[model samples]
Target: MTPRPAKGGRAPAMSTEQRREMIVRATIPLLIEQGSSVTTRRIAQAAGIGEGTVFRVFTDKEELLDACVAEAMDPGTSLAEIRSIPLDQPLAARLTQAAEALRAHVDRIGAVMGALHATEGRSRAAGRPGTKSPDRQAGMNAATDAIAGLFAPEEDSLRLPPRQLAQLFFGLLFTSSIQESPQDIGPVVDVFLHGALASTG
Candidate 1:
């Protein structure tokens, strides 16, 4: 017999790993609502676990914050879902679907992006160019490539250097304090993907 999914459906069983995941899930909302000044006791309370458990799993607040940042930025939406969308679909429609999926999966990605941008700016001001860890840079590279593939088969318009544009997109997503509504970001990303300056002038 096929095994049943977790309580939230498709999330697997509520093992220790699941508990850790749940705790991380709880951390973001708390961080957003309360700001980064959140204490371990508060995080544990929000996670509905004993305060000691938080320490047991994560060595300290910095470790927990790192975990929170990692989880918050991850695109929870599966690439398979995007691939399943009909190939014949119009570029606008496909792009809209992808944006919506991104919005849903990493709703808090904006916050994380903002943090990264701030760090980058500070590093630049301090004369530490591209100081982000090798691992982070690698992850950013991978995310860029994956994002680029979403615009396949429409080479003339959608095609851009994935590596370079990925840097721009990541910078824009993180640096700009744009509180764009769903409708806004769709066309904005389109213009960005297809050269707005050229179209306007």
Candidate 2:
């Protein structure tokens, strides 16, 4: 007979989504520690699941890795918080908060992408050898859309369209993530909100 999936000598108390999230979370440290050589066995052990259950949840190693990457990169929770920001708050305060939020999200994804590149993305991803993984691209688009929404309410005050603002904001975030010139989002947001030209009045 097929055996039950056990946890602490009892069945695991988790739904499919919860189980999948747990396994993906467990995969994070392994992906960092083991690189491309990370095995399903290790993930199963970390997740406290039977090896067969891992396959049942994810079709194969590539699929599992994709799920892990997607989960790690998803900005849903962060976006929700950004969405709930009081629209009546001062524009500088709102934008500063948004910049900090995006910075934190980018930092996390940067680390995960670094690890993934070491695992496999350094070679064949999809288009060119150095192109971003599909999951990363999707995550980027999602983040841009969410940030764009944050700017939409202030379209009347912005010199540029909300979408354009979103693009520039992301550009600043991507640039700052790689370089040491600017220490944090504070300066970036200042220039983004105030512009380079000095006040005439």
Candidate 3:
């Protein structure tokens, strides 16, 4: 028979996967703030679970760090944000929104990886392969496709096809040193939409 709750009610039971997700979510901020030095006691406190529970979900801290890196690198959230931009919005507005989302996605990956590298002194985070990995390539393709969708409504006005335009736009984003602020990003979008040369009357 299942044991009854004490005076106060107990939280709902979580499956092994659910517990792992909970621990990872709680640990991400700590990893950013403390890097690989973040201790299991702190993680348990943050997760509101016993220290042993963390080990039950992951073999060790290295495994947990790998999970955090995976979450940071995943492009699903950014793609959803880009895809949700309304097609009715002007081309510039749509691209600006997409740019912001993509920049934030890149920033997140950098932050998590930077923190881990600072403490670990490794070229790449444990368990994450090179960018040439199939999973990483697939994520890059998905992000480009999502950005390409933004140009669909303005296909006639554009000189190049939407997919090619997207590849260029994405390249510009990754190659250039863009700040997080919208003000900084707006001019870049403007330059992309219109040539750098001044238009004469």
Candidate 4:
């Protein structure tokens, strides 16, 4: 028979990266809700780990906030979600789903950056200048390509190429103040598919 271990044995240890990921995941919502004012103690409570665990994973709160910023900016998750949209759906419905995913992506970046700006006096950069860093440009290109995939099936019916339409779609999304309702995306998709001109028929 195998020997029994002590009743009060400690839990198995997690690797450093695993611990950091856990803490960062827990902290993101708190940062969105409480901004930079969220405390390490609170983060520890949220992760169900001791306060010192966070310090062991991250050198300090600022370093942890930096990790959060990096996480918020990474487009991998959003791209995966957009790619998973079923292609058999109607063109409008597909685009709307993509739009919603992109919008949520933008919102996450905004919330984290807004929180950082509030406490760090950091300036939120504006506009797509020619000087965008290579990584930023690459991410944008990936997002555009993902959006373009939604238009692939309708290519023969489209007046413009899928890539160009994708760029135009991004333009509309950035300019329009879309809300968290299916109704809001309807008009945006309609405008993109048709036009802003009133029907004269």
RMSD of each: 7.4, 6.0, 4.6, 6.2
Candidate 2: give the clashing pairs: none
Error of 3 at 13 (Å): 2.5
Best by lDDT: 3
TM-score of each: 0.57, 0.66, 0.86, 0.82
Best first by lDDT, ranked: 3, 4, 2, 1
Residues 98-127 of candidate 1 have per-residue lDDT tens digits of 555555555676665455455442111112
Task: Supply the TM-score for candidate 3.
Answer: 0.86
Candidate 2, 1-201: lDDT as tens digits:
223779678765677777778788898778766765788998999988899989888777777666666655667767776777777887666766766666666566666667778766422233233334556667677767777777766788778887788888878766664442234556777787787787999
lDDT of each: 0.60, 0.70, 0.83, 0.82
lDDT of 2: 0.70
What is the Cα root-mean-square deviation between model 4 and the actual structure?
Answer: 6.2
Runs in model 1 deviating more than 4 A are 1-16, 75-88, 100-134, 153-179, 189-201
Model 3, position 65, has a per-residue lDDT of 80
Can you rank all candidates by TM-score, best first? 3, 4, 2, 1
**Cα lDDT for residue 94, model 2?**
70
The candidate with the higher TM-score, 1 or 3, is 3
lDDT of 3 at 73: 78
* Candidate 3 lDDT for residue 112: 86
Q: Where is the poorest 10-residue window by lDDT in model 3?
A: 125-134
Stretch of 10 with least lDDT, candidate 2: 122-131
Residue 64 displacement in candidate 4 (angstroms): 0.1
Error of 3 at 29 (Å): 0.8
TM-score of 4: 0.82
Model with the higher TM-score, candidate 1 or 4: 4
